[model samples]
Target: MPTDIAFYTNPMSRGQIARWMLEEVGQPYDMTILDYDGTMKAADYLAINPMGKVPAIVHKGKVVTEAAAICAYLADAFPDAGLAPPVDQRADYYRWLFFAAGPVEAAVSNKSLGLTVPEGRERSMGYGSYDQTVTTLEKAVSGGQWICGDQFTAADVYVGSQVDWGLTFGTIDSRPAFEAYAARLRERPAYKRQKELDGALIAQMQKSS
Candidate 1:
Protein backbone atom coordinates (compact mmCIF):
# COMPACT_ATOMS: atom_id res chain seq x y z
CA MET A 1 0.00 0.00 0.00
CA PRO A 2 1.17 3.52 -0.70
CA THR A 3 2.20 5.24 2.50
CA ASP A 4 1.56 8.80 1.38
CA ILE A 5 -1.49 10.39 3.04
CA ALA A 6 -3.54 13.30 1.74
CA PHE A 7 -5.62 15.33 4.20
CA TYR A 8 -8.58 17.37 2.95
CA THR A 9 -9.75 20.12 5.26
CA ASN A 10 -10.39 23.77 5.93
CA PRO A 11 -8.43 25.36 8.75
CA MET A 12 -11.49 26.50 10.71
CA SER A 13 -13.41 23.23 10.66
CA ARG A 14 -13.44 20.00 12.69
CA GLY A 15 -10.53 18.97 10.47
CA GLN A 16 -8.38 20.38 13.25
CA ILE A 17 -8.98 17.19 15.18
CA ALA A 18 -7.72 15.07 12.31
CA ARG A 19 -4.72 17.35 11.87
CA TRP A 20 -3.83 16.85 15.54
CA MET A 21 -4.07 13.11 15.06
CA LEU A 22 -1.75 13.33 12.06
CA GLU A 23 0.76 15.31 14.10
CA GLU A 24 0.57 12.79 16.92
CA VAL A 25 1.36 10.09 14.37
CA GLY A 26 4.34 12.22 13.33
CA GLN A 27 4.12 11.41 9.66
CA PRO A 28 4.59 13.63 6.64
CA TYR A 29 1.36 14.20 4.72
CA ASP A 30 -0.08 16.55 2.13
CA MET A 31 -2.98 18.85 2.94
CA THR A 32 -5.62 20.29 0.58
CA ILE A 33 -7.60 23.23 1.85
CA LEU A 34 -11.09 23.62 0.38
CA ASP A 35 -13.13 26.78 0.43
CA TYR A 36 -16.85 26.41 1.05
CA ASP A 37 -18.05 28.01 -2.19
CA GLY A 38 -15.19 27.13 -4.48
CA THR A 39 -13.45 23.74 -4.77
CA MET A 40 -15.33 22.15 -1.90
CA LYS A 41 -18.37 21.33 -4.00
CA ALA A 42 -16.51 20.57 -7.21
CA ALA A 43 -16.99 17.21 -8.89
CA ASP A 44 -13.43 15.96 -8.36
CA TYR A 45 -13.56 16.57 -4.62
CA LEU A 46 -16.98 14.97 -4.42
CA ALA A 47 -15.58 11.78 -5.91
CA ILE A 48 -13.15 11.43 -3.01
CA ASN A 49 -15.79 12.23 -0.41
CA PRO A 50 -19.41 12.12 -1.47
CA MET A 51 -20.44 14.35 1.41
CA GLY A 52 -17.90 17.01 0.42
CA LYS A 53 -17.06 17.53 4.04
CA VAL A 54 -13.94 18.86 5.67
CA PRO A 55 -11.58 16.45 7.49
CA ALA A 56 -11.12 13.59 5.06
CA ILE A 57 -7.97 11.59 4.51
CA VAL A 58 -6.71 9.41 1.67
CA HIS A 59 -4.01 6.92 2.61
CA LYS A 60 -2.82 3.63 1.16
CA GLY A 61 -5.16 4.26 -1.77
CA LYS A 62 -8.14 4.24 0.62
CA VAL A 63 -10.30 7.14 1.62
CA VAL A 64 -11.19 7.69 5.25
CA THR A 65 -13.89 10.14 6.23
CA GLU A 66 -15.25 11.37 9.57
CA ALA A 67 -13.07 12.88 12.27
CA ALA A 68 -13.32 10.07 14.83
CA ALA A 69 -12.73 7.39 12.21
CA ILE A 70 -9.72 9.23 10.88
CA CYS A 71 -8.28 9.61 14.38
CA ALA A 72 -8.69 5.90 15.19
CA TYR A 73 -7.33 4.86 11.78
CA LEU A 74 -4.18 6.95 12.08
CA ALA A 75 -3.57 5.74 15.65
CA ASP A 76 -3.69 2.10 14.63
CA ALA A 77 -1.85 2.65 11.37
CA PHE A 78 1.05 4.32 13.18
CA PRO A 79 1.37 2.27 16.31
CA ASP A 80 4.60 4.09 17.16
CA ALA A 81 2.44 7.05 18.09
CA GLY A 82 1.18 5.04 21.08
CA LEU A 83 -2.21 6.67 20.69
CA ALA A 84 -4.17 3.47 20.35
CA PRO A 85 -5.12 1.62 23.50
CA PRO A 86 -4.20 -2.03 23.97
CA VAL A 87 -6.86 -4.62 23.24
CA ASP A 88 -7.90 -4.91 26.87
CA GLN A 89 -8.55 -1.18 27.18
CA ARG A 90 -10.40 -0.85 23.89
CA ALA A 91 -13.83 -1.13 25.50
CA ASP A 92 -13.80 2.38 26.88
CA TYR A 93 -11.81 3.63 23.92
CA TYR A 94 -14.42 2.55 21.39
CA ARG A 95 -17.31 3.39 23.70
CA TRP A 96 -16.42 7.01 24.23
CA LEU A 97 -15.24 7.49 20.66
CA PHE A 98 -18.57 6.46 19.20
CA PHE A 99 -20.48 8.19 21.98
CA ALA A 100 -18.82 11.48 21.17
CA ALA A 101 -19.24 11.00 17.44
CA GLY A 102 -22.84 9.92 17.61
CA PRO A 103 -24.89 11.00 20.63
CA VAL A 104 -22.78 13.90 21.80
CA GLU A 105 -22.39 15.27 18.29
CA ALA A 106 -26.09 14.98 17.52
CA ALA A 107 -27.13 16.53 20.82
CA VAL A 108 -24.72 19.41 20.67
CA SER A 109 -25.29 20.06 16.95
CA ASN A 110 -29.06 19.84 17.18
CA LYS A 111 -29.07 22.15 20.15
CA SER A 112 -26.88 24.58 18.27
CA LEU A 113 -29.29 24.53 15.32
CA GLY A 114 -32.10 25.42 17.76
CA LEU A 115 -33.80 22.08 17.38
CA THR A 116 -34.93 20.11 20.42
CA VAL A 117 -35.44 16.38 20.63
CA PRO A 118 -38.79 17.06 22.30
CA GLU A 119 -39.68 16.25 25.92
CA GLY A 120 -41.45 12.88 25.66
CA ARG A 121 -39.20 11.51 22.90
CA GLU A 122 -36.06 11.47 25.03
CA ARG A 123 -36.49 7.73 25.51
CA SER A 124 -36.90 7.21 21.78
CA MET A 125 -34.00 9.28 20.51
CA GLY A 126 -30.49 7.85 20.65
CA TYR A 127 -29.06 11.02 22.18
CA GLY A 128 -31.84 11.40 24.75
CA SER A 129 -32.04 15.14 25.46
CA TYR A 130 -29.33 17.78 25.37
CA ASP A 131 -29.27 18.17 29.15
CA GLN A 132 -29.21 14.44 29.81
CA THR A 133 -26.64 13.93 27.10
CA VAL A 134 -24.16 16.44 28.49
CA THR A 135 -24.73 15.42 32.11
CA THR A 136 -24.22 11.69 31.54
CA LEU A 137 -21.34 12.51 29.21
CA GLU A 138 -19.57 14.52 31.91
CA LYS A 139 -19.63 11.53 34.25
CA ALA A 140 -18.17 9.16 31.68
CA VAL A 141 -15.28 11.38 30.62
CA SER A 142 -14.84 14.79 32.26
CA GLY A 143 -14.30 13.24 35.71
CA GLY A 144 -11.32 11.29 34.36
CA GLN A 145 -8.23 12.79 32.84
CA TRP A 146 -8.75 10.72 29.72
CA ILE A 147 -11.63 8.70 28.40
CA CYS A 148 -9.81 5.35 28.44
CA GLY A 149 -8.14 6.17 31.76
CA ASP A 150 -4.72 7.67 32.48
CA GLN A 151 -3.01 7.08 29.15
CA PHE A 152 -4.50 9.32 26.49
CA THR A 153 -5.54 7.53 23.33
CA ALA A 154 -7.22 8.43 20.03
CA ALA A 155 -10.41 8.63 22.07
CA ASP A 156 -9.15 11.85 23.60
CA VAL A 157 -8.76 13.42 20.15
CA TYR A 158 -12.44 12.89 19.41
CA VAL A 159 -13.79 13.53 22.91
CA GLY A 160 -11.56 16.50 23.57
CA SER A 161 -12.55 18.14 20.27
CA GLN A 162 -16.19 18.01 21.29
CA VAL A 163 -15.44 19.26 24.79
CA ASP A 164 -13.16 22.04 23.61
CA TRP A 165 -15.57 23.18 20.91
CA GLY A 166 -18.51 23.00 23.28
CA LEU A 167 -16.81 25.01 25.98
CA THR A 168 -15.57 27.59 23.48
CA PHE A 169 -19.01 28.21 21.97
CA GLY A 170 -20.93 27.83 25.25
CA THR A 171 -22.92 25.04 23.66
CA ILE A 172 -22.24 22.78 26.62
CA ASP A 173 -22.22 23.52 30.32
CA SER A 174 -19.03 24.81 31.95
CA ARG A 175 -18.87 22.17 34.61
CA PRO A 176 -15.71 21.87 36.71
CA ALA A 177 -14.80 18.57 35.13
CA PHE A 178 -15.15 20.05 31.64
CA GLU A 179 -13.02 23.11 32.32
CA ALA A 180 -10.26 20.97 33.83
CA TYR A 181 -10.40 18.52 30.94
CA ALA A 182 -10.29 21.19 28.21
CA ALA A 183 -7.36 22.85 29.96
CA ARG A 184 -5.45 19.59 29.89
CA LEU A 185 -6.27 18.95 26.22
CA ARG A 186 -4.98 22.38 25.22
CA GLU A 187 -1.67 21.53 26.93
CA ARG A 188 -0.78 18.69 24.54
CA PRO A 189 2.11 19.25 22.15
CA ALA A 190 0.23 17.79 19.21
CA TYR A 191 -2.88 19.82 20.00
CA LYS A 192 -0.79 22.97 20.27
CA ARG A 193 0.89 22.22 16.98
CA GLN A 194 -2.47 21.82 15.33
CA LYS A 195 -3.67 25.10 16.80
CA GLU A 196 -0.59 27.00 15.61
CA LEU A 197 -0.62 25.59 12.11
CA ASP A 198 -4.37 25.85 11.64
CA GLY A 199 -4.45 29.31 13.21
CA ALA A 200 -1.83 30.57 10.79
CA LEU A 201 -3.63 28.95 7.89
CA ILE A 202 -6.89 30.55 8.97
CA ALA A 203 -5.23 33.92 9.16
CA GLN A 204 -3.62 33.52 5.75
CA MET A 205 -6.95 32.54 4.25
CA GLN A 206 -8.69 35.47 5.87
CA LYS A 207 -6.08 37.94 4.59
CA SER A 208 -6.16 36.54 1.07
CA SER A 209 -9.95 36.70 0.98
Candidate 2:
Protein backbone atom coordinates (compact mmCIF):
# COMPACT_ATOMS: atom_id res chain seq x y z
CA MET A 1 0.00 0.00 0.00
CA PRO A 2 1.22 3.48 -0.75
CA THR A 3 1.94 5.78 2.16
CA ASP A 4 -0.96 7.97 3.14
CA ILE A 5 0.60 11.41 3.41
CA ALA A 6 -1.50 14.17 4.90
CA PHE A 7 -0.05 17.67 5.20
CA TYR A 8 -1.59 20.27 7.49
CA THR A 9 -0.49 23.73 6.42
CA ASN A 10 -1.18 27.42 6.04
CA PRO A 11 0.20 28.59 2.71
CA MET A 12 1.39 31.91 4.12
CA SER A 13 3.44 30.39 6.92
CA ARG A 14 6.16 27.77 7.44
CA GLY A 15 3.81 25.42 5.66
CA GLN A 16 5.47 26.58 2.50
CA ILE A 17 8.63 24.79 3.57
CA ALA A 18 6.77 21.49 3.93
CA ARG A 19 5.15 22.11 0.56
CA TRP A 20 8.57 22.48 -1.02
CA MET A 21 9.73 19.28 0.68
CA LEU A 22 6.67 17.46 -0.65
CA GLU A 23 7.52 18.64 -4.11
CA GLU A 24 11.11 17.53 -3.69
CA VAL A 25 9.99 14.10 -2.54
CA GLY A 26 7.54 13.99 -5.45
CA GLN A 27 4.90 12.53 -3.21
CA PRO A 28 1.15 12.85 -3.59
CA TYR A 29 -0.08 14.44 -0.37
CA ASP A 30 -3.45 15.64 0.87
CA MET A 31 -3.26 19.27 1.95
CA THR A 32 -5.47 20.71 4.66
CA ILE A 33 -4.97 24.44 4.77
CA LEU A 34 -5.67 25.89 8.18
CA ASP A 35 -6.69 29.42 9.05
CA TYR A 36 -5.12 31.11 12.06
CA ASP A 37 -8.44 32.36 13.47
CA GLY A 38 -9.30 29.26 15.48
CA THR A 39 -9.17 26.93 12.49
CA MET A 40 -5.79 25.51 13.35
CA LYS A 41 -6.66 25.69 17.01
CA ALA A 42 -9.70 23.50 16.46
CA ALA A 43 -9.81 20.21 18.31
CA ASP A 44 -9.24 18.10 15.20
CA TYR A 45 -6.16 20.04 14.09
CA LEU A 46 -4.87 20.27 17.64
CA ALA A 47 -5.15 16.48 17.92
CA ILE A 48 -2.72 16.12 15.08
CA ASN A 49 -0.44 18.82 16.49
CA PRO A 50 -0.83 19.88 20.09
CA MET A 51 1.09 23.05 19.43
CA GLY A 52 -1.58 24.10 16.93
CA LYS A 53 0.94 24.77 14.21
CA VAL A 54 0.71 24.14 10.52
CA PRO A 55 3.21 22.05 8.46
CA ALA A 56 2.56 18.87 10.37
CA ILE A 57 2.42 15.59 8.47
CA VAL A 58 0.74 12.25 9.00
CA HIS A 59 2.37 9.39 7.11
CA LYS A 60 1.56 5.71 7.54
CA GLY A 61 -0.32 6.51 10.76
CA LYS A 62 2.64 8.38 12.26
CA VAL A 63 2.45 12.10 12.89
CA VAL A 64 5.45 14.36 12.38
CA THR A 65 5.69 18.01 13.39
CA GLU A 66 8.21 20.76 12.74
CA ALA A 67 9.12 21.77 9.20
CA ALA A 68 12.65 20.40 9.40
CA ALA A 69 11.51 17.07 10.81
CA ILE A 70 8.89 16.72 8.12
CA CYS A 71 11.41 17.46 5.41
CA ALA A 72 13.88 14.94 6.78
CA TYR A 73 11.18 12.32 7.17
CA LEU A 74 9.95 12.70 3.62
CA ALA A 75 13.45 12.45 2.26
CA ASP A 76 14.09 9.23 4.12
CA ALA A 77 10.69 7.71 3.38
CA PHE A 78 11.00 8.46 -0.32
CA PRO A 79 14.50 7.31 -1.02
CA ASP A 80 13.64 6.93 -4.68
CA ALA A 81 13.57 10.73 -4.93
CA GLY A 82 17.27 10.78 -3.96
CA LEU A 83 16.81 13.79 -1.70
CA ALA A 84 18.66 12.13 1.18
CA PRO A 85 22.19 10.86 1.55
CA PRO A 86 23.03 7.24 2.26
CA VAL A 87 23.85 5.85 5.71
CA ASP A 88 27.46 6.81 5.18
CA GLN A 89 26.62 10.49 4.94
CA ARG A 90 23.95 10.43 7.58
CA ALA A 91 26.06 12.26 10.18
CA ASP A 92 26.78 15.27 7.96
CA TYR A 93 23.18 15.24 6.76
CA TYR A 94 21.74 15.49 10.27
CA ARG A 95 24.35 18.03 11.29
CA TRP A 96 23.56 20.63 8.64
CA LEU A 97 19.86 19.87 8.68
CA PHE A 98 19.51 20.55 12.42
CA PHE A 99 22.00 23.38 12.15
CA ALA A 100 19.62 25.05 9.78
CA ALA A 101 16.63 24.60 12.07
CA GLY A 102 18.51 25.35 15.28
CA PRO A 103 21.42 27.76 15.04
CA VAL A 104 20.52 29.31 11.73
CA GLU A 105 16.98 29.92 12.86
CA ALA A 106 18.09 31.35 16.19
CA ALA A 107 20.50 33.75 14.51
CA VAL A 108 17.97 34.92 11.97
CA SER A 109 15.23 35.40 14.52
CA ASN A 110 17.54 37.28 16.87
CA LYS A 111 18.85 39.49 14.10
CA SER A 112 15.35 40.32 12.94
CA LEU A 113 14.32 41.26 16.45
CA GLY A 114 17.50 43.37 16.94
CA LEU A 115 18.41 41.24 19.93
CA THR A 116 22.09 40.75 20.72
CA VAL A 117 23.89 38.78 23.37
CA PRO A 118 26.78 40.06 25.42
CA GLU A 119 30.25 39.54 23.92
CA GLY A 120 31.26 37.08 26.64
CA ARG A 121 28.07 35.08 26.16
CA GLU A 122 28.79 34.30 22.51
CA ARG A 123 29.94 30.75 23.27
CA SER A 124 26.84 30.12 25.35
CA MET A 125 24.69 31.00 22.38
CA GLY A 126 24.23 28.13 19.95
CA TYR A 127 24.78 30.34 16.95
CA GLY A 128 27.56 32.30 18.63
CA SER A 129 26.42 35.47 16.89
CA TYR A 130 24.55 36.51 13.79
CA ASP A 131 27.74 37.60 12.07
CA GLN A 132 29.45 34.32 12.91
CA THR A 133 26.58 32.28 11.58
CA VAL A 134 26.47 34.24 8.35
CA THR A 135 30.21 34.01 7.89
CA THR A 136 30.21 30.26 8.52
CA LEU A 137 27.35 29.79 6.07
CA GLU A 138 29.16 31.88 3.49
CA LYS A 139 32.20 29.63 3.75
CA ALA A 140 30.01 26.54 3.48
CA VAL A 141 28.72 27.78 0.12
CA SER A 142 31.86 29.53 -1.07
CA GLY A 143 33.01 26.69 -3.31
CA GLY A 144 30.16 27.50 -5.69
CA GLN A 145 28.37 24.28 -4.86
CA TRP A 146 25.77 22.70 -2.60
CA ILE A 147 26.11 22.40 1.17
CA CYS A 148 27.01 18.71 1.02
CA GLY A 149 29.89 19.38 -1.35
CA ASP A 150 28.83 18.12 -4.79
CA GLN A 151 25.59 16.44 -3.89
CA PHE A 152 22.39 18.32 -3.11
CA THR A 153 20.57 16.57 -0.31
CA ALA A 154 17.63 17.32 1.99
CA ALA A 155 19.96 19.50 4.01
CA ASP A 156 20.06 21.88 1.07
CA VAL A 157 16.29 21.91 0.85
CA TYR A 158 16.04 22.98 4.50
CA VAL A 159 19.01 25.34 4.69
CA GLY A 160 18.53 26.55 1.14
CA SER A 161 14.94 27.48 1.95
CA GLN A 162 16.19 29.64 4.83
CA VAL A 163 18.83 31.27 2.62
CA ASP A 164 16.30 31.98 -0.10
CA TRP A 165 13.63 33.30 2.26
CA GLY A 166 16.12 35.42 4.15
CA LEU A 167 17.44 37.01 0.99
CA THR A 168 13.95 37.54 -0.43
CA PHE A 169 12.74 39.35 2.70
CA GLY A 170 15.98 41.33 3.16
CA THR A 171 16.42 39.71 6.57
CA ILE A 172 19.91 38.52 5.57
CA ASP A 173 22.62 40.27 3.66
CA SER A 174 23.13 39.28 0.05
CA ARG A 175 26.70 38.10 0.06
CA PRO A 176 28.24 36.59 -3.05
CA ALA A 177 28.12 33.09 -1.57
CA PHE A 178 24.52 33.39 -0.45
CA GLU A 179 23.52 34.79 -3.83
CA ALA A 180 25.13 31.94 -5.71
CA TYR A 181 23.69 29.31 -3.36
CA ALA A 182 20.19 30.73 -3.64
CA ALA A 183 20.56 30.91 -7.40
CA ARG A 184 21.50 27.24 -7.53
CA LEU A 185 18.45 26.27 -5.47
CA ARG A 186 16.16 28.45 -7.59
CA GLU A 187 17.38 26.73 -10.73
CA ARG A 188 15.95 23.40 -9.60
CA PRO A 189 13.01 22.43 -11.80
CA ALA A 190 11.12 21.04 -8.82
CA TYR A 191 11.54 24.24 -6.86
CA LYS A 192 10.44 26.30 -9.86
CA ARG A 193 7.36 24.15 -10.43
CA GLN A 194 6.26 24.37 -6.79
CA LYS A 195 6.89 28.12 -6.60
CA GLU A 196 4.92 28.78 -9.76
CA LEU A 197 1.93 26.82 -8.49
CA ASP A 198 2.04 28.47 -5.05
CA GLY A 199 2.59 31.92 -6.54
CA ALA A 200 -0.55 31.63 -8.63
CA LEU A 201 -2.57 30.48 -5.64
CA ILE A 202 -1.25 33.39 -3.56
CA ALA A 203 -2.08 35.86 -6.33
CA GLN A 204 -5.61 34.55 -6.62
CA MET A 205 -6.07 34.82 -2.87
CA GLN A 206 -4.80 38.38 -2.92
CA LYS A 207 -7.17 39.31 -5.75
CA SER A 208 -10.10 37.79 -3.92
CA SER A 209 -9.18 39.59 -0.70
In order, candidate lDDTs are 0.90, 0.85
Task: Show pairs that collide, candidate 2.
Answer: none
lDDT tens string, model 1, 149-178?
798899999999999999999999999889
The TM-score measured for candidate 1 stands at 0.96
Cα RMSD of all models vs. native, in order, equals 1.8, 1.9
| TM-score of candidate 2 against the unseen true structure | 0.93
Candidate 1 structure lDDT: 0.90
Error of 2 at 142 (Å): 2.7
Error of 1 at 4 (Å): 0.9
Task: State which candidate has the highest TM-score.
Answer: 1
lDDT of 2 by residue, 3-59 (tens): 489888877888878888898888788878788887899999899999998889999
Show the lowest summed lDDT stretch of 10 residues, model 2: 138-147
TM-score of each: 0.96, 0.93
